[model samples]
Target: MNSRQGALLRALLNAGDYKTAGEYGRELGCSDRTVRSDVKALNAALAREGFHSHVDRQRGAGLRIVVVPDEENRLVRLLGEAEAEMHPRYERLCQEMLALTCHPGPHTADLLARRMFRNKQQIQADLHWWQGVLELSGLSLSLGRYLKVEGPEWTIRGFVMSMLFSFPAPAVRRRILPSLVGSLDPYDRQFLERCIAEMQRDLGFEFSSNAQWQFGVYLCIMVTRIRLGHSLAAWRDAREPGPFFAYLQKRLERHFSMTVSDAEMGLLRDMANCCTWQWSLAAMEAYEPTERARALADAIASALADAFGAPVPDDMRKPLAILLESGLARRGCGLVAPNPNEEAVKYEAMDGACLLSSVLAEVPALVEADLFSPDYARLLLVLFDYLEQVGALRCYRVGLVVNCGIDLALWGAHRIEKLSSRLQVTDVLTENEVAAAAARPGSALAERFDFLVSFEPLDVKFPSVTISPAVSRADIDHIIASVPLWRRGREVRTAWEQEVLPVGPSPEGLFAALHGRLVDEGLVDMPRERFEWLLWTLSIVKDRTLVLAWCGPGVRRTGIRIFRLEEGDGAECGRCTMAAVLVVAPADRGDLTPLTQGFKRLVEDYADTSGAVNDDGFFVCFPDPE
Candidate 1:
């Protein structure tokens, strides 16, 4: 089946209800006639294949699939296999990347084209894609005569691991990684898988499915690389041996006839920590959060709760805190994992992400952390979005009204509570009350609630939805859809822009210019010497192209300025190209950590890499009105 046909089939199966062809066409980006044609073809194929399912079209209600309950699983499985067969790009990319990394070569585009059965143009496109991927890790792919990835050994290894385990689905990774590794024999791959399973059993805890796959893939790559004489001997470490060092050391030597050094064992230990909770009680004891991590996590959780105007439950708070702790450690090591869902999250939750960045910037403890990267925000965004789905961040305070008897109005209130845990019926309003609220848009009745829902038509200045007194399915769906519109109106704030400044020779000089602006605008009255000292002491250089500095307490505003680092201008400030400078004021608790982190997030969103800034300047944010 083609991708569109497969998508149509999956949608019908997932919905399990009738939907008009027009709806499917709009959702799948096709015409109504095309959707109907695909459905007809898909049904014939399903019947021919002996699947006990067929898409049945209804006159007005639209089309839905009729599936035998027992055959549903098999039908879904077949559909998935067909979809995988249709899209082989991800698998090919994995194979091409592994090929370049494993063999030493000026692996030319011509050679890759022949090996992968693609034209040179296709191979070049692949190379371009790889360039973007490597750039995320601050690495580069040399495209001269042959293709080769160039970077520090540790970074290259991390990149490989990230790529291999990036696809979170266990079944997909298991099917892809082993077959892509050209050097690993079937017996050896199985041995490594068995070894990972044994380790998990011995540790008295099962690795999460994704972790199990990650562990197996990591060992396979490491062993294959080692056999190829690419040992990480130069990657030195003097730390004590890990708890699993002895155990893993014996297994590798016994099975592969190779012994591992302390550095290799240390690497294994770190990987294990990331893949599982702990190996033993001692490890758990040693894994206690540092005081800084705990404080920052608490502050983040509290800020998130405040922004949503809801109390985060202990279950939600605990995971968020743990993520912050690990995120802080990962940032310290300069290891940022790619957020597979970054673009999707950014598109779907733009308002939440912006508000979250603002809240994080105000966090007092976040100043000491380097955890303000896009990957980190994406992770938090995914979590926050998930929490909203599960009703943990449910803050839709709704007002209820009915033209029926008081008893029915009370019943409608309870029905709304059952319709979705997200809606809270804060008040049951009378006709007179509704009229009063309509007259005064800023009345307590209007201000105290988010939206009004009534069984009958009621004129009110507040956002209102009309629903059945019994809350029908259509009404529930309408309420569900309206929530986001209300949320957007409440959460999205207007961001003000400031003037960009020219790149100064040094951060000290930049601060002098900014100090002059703040002084003239009546924003700050600090002496130049003190501002210079803060710039020197409280600044962070990132990607050799961006700098963030704290403009100590009592400043009236927080802003970001893009400084033009013309040609070699950045060298003086330890930057290589056009750089961004963030000047932040202290948060309420007397620390600039929150604002610094927040500004980093803003920079990530607005910094133009595609030559969008022609004036040698990029200024994006303004001071908080408060």
Candidate 2:
């Protein structure tokens, strides 16, 4: 079934009750007669396949899908396979290319086009795009009399494994894996899942559900790629392949009859290396990082300090080294790779992308090199937890000014006071006399506190968060998470007030520019909500080397996105360039309006402890509404 059929089938299956003909038609965006016709075709297809389900219809009730009692799994798999094959253009092309990679062989252009259900021109266009897709995995796609994927043997294997690792888990909300390399050996898949559970227990590091899927698919693919003769050969048993590679090669050599290359063997060992990493800090460091990787780690630490004014503690250097080394294998071999936790880290962990992206900005040349990935963000989070645990991450001093309009509001202020020790409450002033509080502003009280909390909104020159006196446990927990990040909005307001000439790009232009940057920099594609994209776009704010804000259509119309560029070593007030690109990472385009409040909140969080700017200032910006 194609997308239409898949959409229709999914709608029907997801419904708990019968649907009307008009309802089904509306849901599928078709005429009732058309849906009925499609239903007939669907029923025919199901009957032809000997499936135990058919669309049953009642005059008023639209349609109901009845599944056989024990045929649920079978029907689901059938529908999944059918849905995977229905593609429109690029996706279909990608699918065909993947199929070619899986079993590269002789086929004339006419024959290939016929097999792909496309014309010759479409096939050629697909081939063109396929070339670009291959480059991401360090492979080259070439079509001759026979289809062949040409690349260094190691890279070819890497390309395949990376693709395999990217396969969507069966349990994904949408199972979008194309036909090629989509199916898994049931027994092998089970074994790998069990292995992930065992590894998590052994290592004492929890794996998110997604992480387990990543590792399982990666390990399973390694085995499948080997048995299929897509492996490496050992030129020498000694250090040529490295000891880890040699050891893994011996383990797998008996399992596979084909020759395994040193690269392939090395890739397999990296699977363990990644596991060691996810397992525990000490276990990960046991596999020493290469000097180059260690040096890169040092440079990373130094650059973060240089760029963000935050120093990476020296004690955490070893873990950074291990992470860098594992990153090398993941990137180099393109085998089992970790799903980046950038989403959790970006807004959650204090814009974690800053550390890595800053490193890229320092050495612009490394933008396309090994430095940028969601994986980099994950590494930073691990570092952040350790630093916080050791009390290296700085905390802000806060004060509370409670003036209760009601008893509940007063209680909330007390709750804020009773928060964890991370926040050292400098003072708490209970303003029982409203006339006195109104007569005398809390500006001085607000100034004394790094963070200001109040039951009643105070007319203080610093930002004061007015909370209900009766806060819930969850609200308190949220406050705890945010306490360390509490910045007086005044600081961000000041940083933003003194602004540079802003760049505005139309949504289209913004995406195009970002997409261009990704390709030019040889960087992997980012998620749709890419914070790195935001950082890259905002390059106008700081010294990431943009001549001027690439002002497009929106910045003038959209709310301003601001960031602080703290003075670093060799960094002084003499410099003229001042800006940060405020675009989202990786994916090119989306409306920036939704991010306005979030942008203000994050900037405030970043500048929470900056003692500049008046405490009563608002931390928001408004665009010139057209």
Candidate 3:
């Protein structure tokens, strides 16, 4: 149909019940004579479709479509036509409808319908059809019919706004349909849209509907999690590759082929860097210099390229690079040092490099003083160097510093001055104290003096292991069955046995056996401090399955507890005397079946504690130790 005819139909649909020729003419910016002719044409058009329209009027009354067509059929046909048209503007219309349905009020539907070639009845029918389609596609559409109709209103206006901004194409629609359909209401969408818009405006980018939707979905989920007081960062970290990100990646790879240039790669890397930096800053409120930031940037770039299969334009690279370099420099480090004379060039390079150094500093600081090892320090240095090469160092700086109470001058006589400065060591050790400690055999300060850095304490401790309360003996059995060593004659038990059972079977044997099982199953590492902390926690929780005990009248009753490894040393659990309670002795033959059977029972009963119980007790179970 011609645009004029469509416009006329839209006006009619928006007018609702009826309108006199004069009123219709006034609304459409046309004359009464023209309105009357348009009405005649509208009737003729309906007649051709096996439907007829009749206008009726009484004295001092208005004109109305007396015979409304079969609205469902007409709406279905119109939607089909709209779909076939593939007009970009149709997306806007859909968004408006979505918005209207969410907060349906008197003239809201009418206003929306006015944009389409359909009457109010047809508009309502179309809404019903769209809602059904969304449901079929795993979405939900809620109508706001409770409010008065005096003005515009809708139930899910926010959602409509978000959808309009987020779902820009059929492909994006398909990707997000599953997650967003039932989860979002109109209001939620609208609110999310506003958030995304604000974020985009702040970032100085005009995001597409697909981009907006993806971000909105993330924001929505995160906001919900935060509102419920859930672990937001942990949840985000745990989320796997969902359909939206997967699909987007696929599309991006398809667009960018294998022969992508350095410039293109750099651009993609920069964009990813910006996004990662923004997200990290928003979530962490802190920045670090290291391969982690670069890796994140690379991941985003690689995913985008792999999905689109097209090289990014050279034009896009410069701006992104500038942003990455600037952000990194402000944070602390960059790959290349910018020229001093060139304000723009130097700032770009130095920013990334500085950011990197800052971030690298944090790794050592997070390490516990007693548990600090040369290996950890080495790992941090390696990570720092890697970050420098990839240009991720520009994102932020690490603020961690070693706090030695005294200056390095006190150790001058020992020629350890360089060691002190090289390690960022603060001389908490006085000159006389160091000399006196050096004379002692195996002094308390000697062993742990190498790594004495400390981190800011957090209210909640980080989770060392992920355990499920739902874990049962069956799960443990499955794990046990997979161990080759557990199978007779499969492998010889030797010095390695000490790795699992440091003191051998009695109580020590049990502890080692459980420790080996956990490590074999990839539930923990071989760090002694980590093991001690976990053991302490397990002791506090008193998991009958994890604790093995032998008690008799005169014999030293021994208890062996199993625990996961943590980051710090035994210092955290120094108050717990579970280690002292362990008994080491020759392998005894007393009631082995009872010990095994009791453990099995405990494993079966191990249920992860929920809510407040989680804070006070160890509710998680390691995978089955077969």
Candidate 4:
């Protein structure tokens, strides 16, 4: 079926009730006749494929899909395959790569182009982009009389496995694989699945659904690649496979009639170790992380400290080390955690994600090895939990000011503290003290407390949430809402600020000028090259101009420098007429939220020095230094 027909079929299948042709037409923005024609064509195609499913239509009630119980799986698979075919470019690229990697013989350009249903020119363009992707994995796309991907067998497998699992759903991957490798024998597939299930039972644990699928798919791919004359050499350095491998090996030989090698068996064992598994409490107690896992954990901890500008408690390392060890094999195999909530975690904790990215960057070993994936969100979530449990997370200090007696004031403070771990009642204050602090914005109280929680409404410069003496749910919600606003609006005390002179249009010129100024002021005390690398690597903050900020080693103090280009100097920084450079000291990294807010405001005010000012904001962040 064509792309539009595929879309129409999907809509019909997903629709809960009979949808009229007119209704479908309106939703798809087509005519009723066109919808009917597509539906008719889809039915014809399904019949031609000998499928027991069809779109049932009634005169007045409209259309619905009818599927027999036995045909349900087959029809669903067909729909999925059709959906995949909708994205020709991506599907073709994946198909081409699979064909090249699985077959040792060079594939002629014409053959690939024909199989992909594309012209030679389009195929060549795809090859060009695919070439760069391979190069990143240290693999080369060999192009000449024919095309092939030249790389180590292990690397090739890892890259392809990474691509396959990238689809997230194991079902989608299962469908795609058969198309690439021709048809898969139902018995062979079931045997491999059974082998994984048996292996899990033998280990006295259960692999997660996705992990089980991973093991099965890995086995299938390994066998296919091996049969196609691509197999890994014996890993002499690694330990030999155990009982489970022997069980799987015997099954593979009996089912597929293929003799499994020691190297292949070892690879399977390593993969099993990395797959996400659930164990009994007794199993957990008996487990200990390897030396390599502990070392990786230490590196991660060091990176976390650098990112947060605070010391990570040594005790936290053990749990992290355990997790690192559990996933070590899968990570090396380029598998990501099968986390359904990954996107949700990222959306909710964006700042935390930014912080984690910066932290993970410090661990060069992880990045170099491609161990850090979208699954980094898991690490960030764990770190946040650990900090909350240990009370080391940066808390929004709240000053409780009440007209009630000290008893009620303390009680209210206690209630507020229970609302969120990120909120801490730093002090119970009377109205007079809050008034006094308002007069002195730089007072010890003003600096200490982020915002105030008052029983009575008070005129104060600091953000305050007026609540009842007995805090209610609504009051709790209000406080929660205000905390974020306070983070974005509060004033920040910087060590210094200055306007930068024109440093030309080149990044080199700008870097040299800023590095010299910072060194002269003793704000940065690092080698010129290192600092220059940092300035570029740091995340940019866009507020009319690209602002780059970093809190780490070279930064001797917290400071911000403003740059305003002359009119017609928009080309100086690529459409930006102004820029702000902020250096945050390690100790003051906790102040990043307010400092960034303050700098944003500062940049907005100074953003229009030139008449040709762009109102857009740009900000980028990099890893914190060691």
Candidate 5:
């Protein structure tokens, strides 16, 4: 069960059928004598388990576990022995060697190299070693060369089990158990139990594996989060007395025969309450109104007390009252009124609204317009309803531009703005600069106007219009000039329109306009040759706008065509055209094919159909016109 023996067995397993002692020695980075000794030790261990190891001298020479005993049991016994006998540091080293390489950013490789004082070659070797180990366990490790680590089922299970044993104390185990088991599914649990059972039966060692402890911690965190809002008060007042927590506790005790102490339960309740209050307050401050926040706080507190095993903290009750008063004082609910003129305030509000809308929109069953309310509690209820509709909320921490004036803008935005500013000074303007200047009139020195506007209608909607090719800069300037007011006007008009009209529901009518002007003798017939070429060229033009007028958001039209032109010599000249049209919609659309796959499939289908065209002397292959 030593490292050397395990290494030999791994080599044999990897080699499949069999391997010579010399081959095994070379792979293990050891001498032939060492390999022989390792084989002998492994065979002895196998013999003890009522399995025989045989080396066929005449059959091309390689040791094999002739009586392939239950592999699951063998692995378990090996793991138990390794755990019992291996030095802590040696065990750590083994784990490290078996660790999957995480896709670290460009800087990560260098950072890890520097920290470990190991070269890139060594790191790569370790990655290979881990991959080999995982292969033995019917698992795979995928590390994005520059991003993240994704371990397969068995590998992940093994890592979790290792982590469980690695903890020195029960408190540490309790703290980490949730993180360890939270990501596992039923299959993972079964695999883990198999590994544990194998170890117990073969090695005569009991694994201190507690499914209840693992599940309890997971349920506790979620239950606490549910009863508490993502605010300061929610975090503070989060207690374990919510019905969900109580139910979870009962389930755990019934299933595992383990009892949770009153003291531990109290502490857990307090922690949940505190977390709940804190998050609730933060969420309220960010999005909800005073009255709504107060109501939400009450609802969450009551929910927590009724379901979980603990009551809301007394301090949280006082703060909730104070928050309500403060909210009312600031606005009607002690919340400050939104300031559109202030860059920070305007951007924050817009960003928050966009985020909230996106989160709610993901839930197909929830009506986003109906969810907006002045009351905090009602808003929270709506948010929860949306989350429930969506089945789950994946919480991710992302950096927000608290002060964009100070923060470096994203590359595309910065580049566009920089080019526009340079174009204002230069005589020769770039295409990008011209586009930017058209979007925002005047030089960058001029006061920037807020483009966002809110309207009081049955449903919240943003005014949007597609730019027509015919619209001139002067025409746009005249429209801007006509509208004296910059804020929400009584009329719905673009920066280019003349007379503003009251904003109405989104228009469903489609308007078609020609881009080019007609001559005095209008509508002249185009030459057949020119028209034919133009139509032929259209096959190559993958622009979605030209192909389909009403493509859904984020959807693009792409296809392939094969054109066969027969010459007088009875020979055919063919051209294969693969076209891809990229369409980015003005708003988010739920269903859209990825651009790459869409193009690839279009080309593949076109090629397949084109190859089977009729033997008519002249042939043109195209997709179904409709």
Candidate 6:
């Protein structure tokens, strides 16, 4: 079947029920007639593969896949990533872009386009898109196809690696690195491995399993390219190498049968830095605010509970706090480490991540951390894991596979997970394993997933959806619209959406009101230095403050977040931050009964909660204006 047919099949299989041709067409980035033709082709392919399943047409509801239990895996193998082969025009262009960046040379645009399975015009359009994205790198597409990625050498290498490999799942990443490293000529691989081990031993620390695996991947990629006569330029002289790297290189060259090139040594030196980089107590303190950061973490856990109107277990606080501190340090200090789970985390726990990052970034201290990075996604995953451990996140099992190119596989899986918060996905297959499972009958993978999602139809008897690798925005919309119909979905979807609602009002107004109230009530505690500093930080933006304030005219009471930073011997509140809600509407002001009731619960909740709360906790200095 053509790529379009495979995509059509995926969309159909993924659907909870039949969708009309127009709906399918809109999702696959194609026309109704094309979708119909592709569906016809897909059914024929299914039959030819001896699968007792076909795309069945419904007059009004749309098309659905009719599946026989035993034939699922075979169908998926027939359509997965191996078959896609840069089939979509856009994918070919993407590959072309990578090829241009990694191995750029003189060639006409027409020649490159033909090589990429595209017409010249389509290639040019893609180049324009690439231009916009690549402008950050000062890279541009030369019209004649002589692609130039002009930037610092290290940046270009990293960008090429990102585009070249399909680093999708953590399992796949761990599995792939060894295979790639092992495939290298025994002497080179062995020597490199021994050097890494020796470095760890001599450095008085071991690299995390993840760091080692990624270093291996980096080495394998760089070595493979070097063997193919592509190596980075000698970016720095030998005299400038890190001390540990210099030592590690000398030991390696002493054992190797061949002389290592300066370029190769440069790469080796980089690997050394990556493996040894640590975020120690001192390093973290360089960013400051560990205690305050811990308080922010407590407030977030508390805020999430209050915002969602659910109680969080006390057990999640410490782990969440640790995750936040590490994330802030890593992002703030520019500690770029390899995190294979970044995609998976972004997919699985996006809302929790959004909420946490949204809360953390409000503090003036953390502005440097672009909490929106994939790093934050990885960090958020840790928080979600903690929540799940404490029975707060509410997760479910999902089985997912991507049969298309690596780009779509990662992108689609991320999209699927982001579109639903309940799903805890397991995607372990590499290109070969997926191909093997697709060709074999009754694979073990079928038993693990409650439902399988694949771009290719699988051969197993498990429930599976075959979607196009090129899942469009329309497809995502349709899938999101269908979430409530999934099993145990109604409550899950509702909670997921509200996990990170936007706070309103401008920064100046939010802080001014809070500051004015604290001063007016003689509750503005702490020295002028500390209070003003806090004000300067918190007042920078209402969006950045971690306060949980709910305001509406119909509310019978207010639930405003108040945090007392620390305690002092005297009666003065020491370093506090609180947002007050003023009631302007007359109808809801009949009694302070609701106020008392709400405050009781909030006080009860925040009592056990560790935040900036003082010993005289949850005190309301402002009396009711009414």
**Highest lDDT, which number?**
4
Clash pairs (backbone) in predicted model 1:
106-146, 107-147, 361-594, 361-595, 367-593
| Minimal lDDT window, size 10, model 6 | 616-625
Against the correct fold, how does model 1 do in TM-score? Answer: 0.64
Model 5, span 512-617: residue lDDT tens: 1110110111322333332222222211212111111111212222221222222235332222122222222324222111222233334333322222111111
Residue range 112-212, candidate 3, lDDT tens digits: 56745456666666555555334422345455652121111111222233233322234335433333344456765675566556545544456554445
In order, the Cα lDDT scores of the candidates are 0.59, 0.49, 0.34, 0.64, 0.32, 0.47
* TM-scores, each model vs. reference: 0.64, 0.54, 0.19, 0.61, 0.23, 0.43
Better of 1 and 3 by TM-score: 1
Local accuracy of candidate 4 as per-residue lDDT tens digits, 361-397: 4577655434433345456656776555544435687
Which model, 1 or 3, shows the larger lDDT?
1
lDDT of 6 at 578: 28
* Reference-based TM-score, model 6: 0.43
What tens digits encode model 1's per-residue C-alpha lDDT throughout 79-127?
Answer: 6455433445655676678878765455899888887788888879878
**C-alpha lDDT (0 to 100) for residue 351 of candidate 5:** 22
Off by over 4 Å in 1: 6-19, 41-56, 63-84, 103-110, 144-146, 166-175, 234-238, 277-318, 325-356, 362-397, 403-411, 418-422, 429-450, 456-462, 468-477, 480-626
- Against the true structure, whose TM-score is highest? 1
Which regions of candidate 6 deviate over 4 angstroms?
Answer: 16-23, 29-34, 48-53, 57-62, 67-91, 94-98, 104-129, 138-147, 165-217, 224-357, 363-366, 385-626
Angstrom error at residue 318, model 3: 37
C-alpha root-mean-square deviation, candidate 3: 31.7
Query: Where does candidate 4 stray beyond 4 Å?
Result: 1-88, 103-106, 180-182, 277-288, 294-319, 334-370, 373-377, 400-416, 426-448, 453-459, 465-490, 493-550, 554-583, 590-626
lDDT of 4 at 372: 37
Q: Report RMSD (Å) for each prediction in the order shown.
A: 10.6, 14.1, 31.7, 11.7, 30.1, 20.9
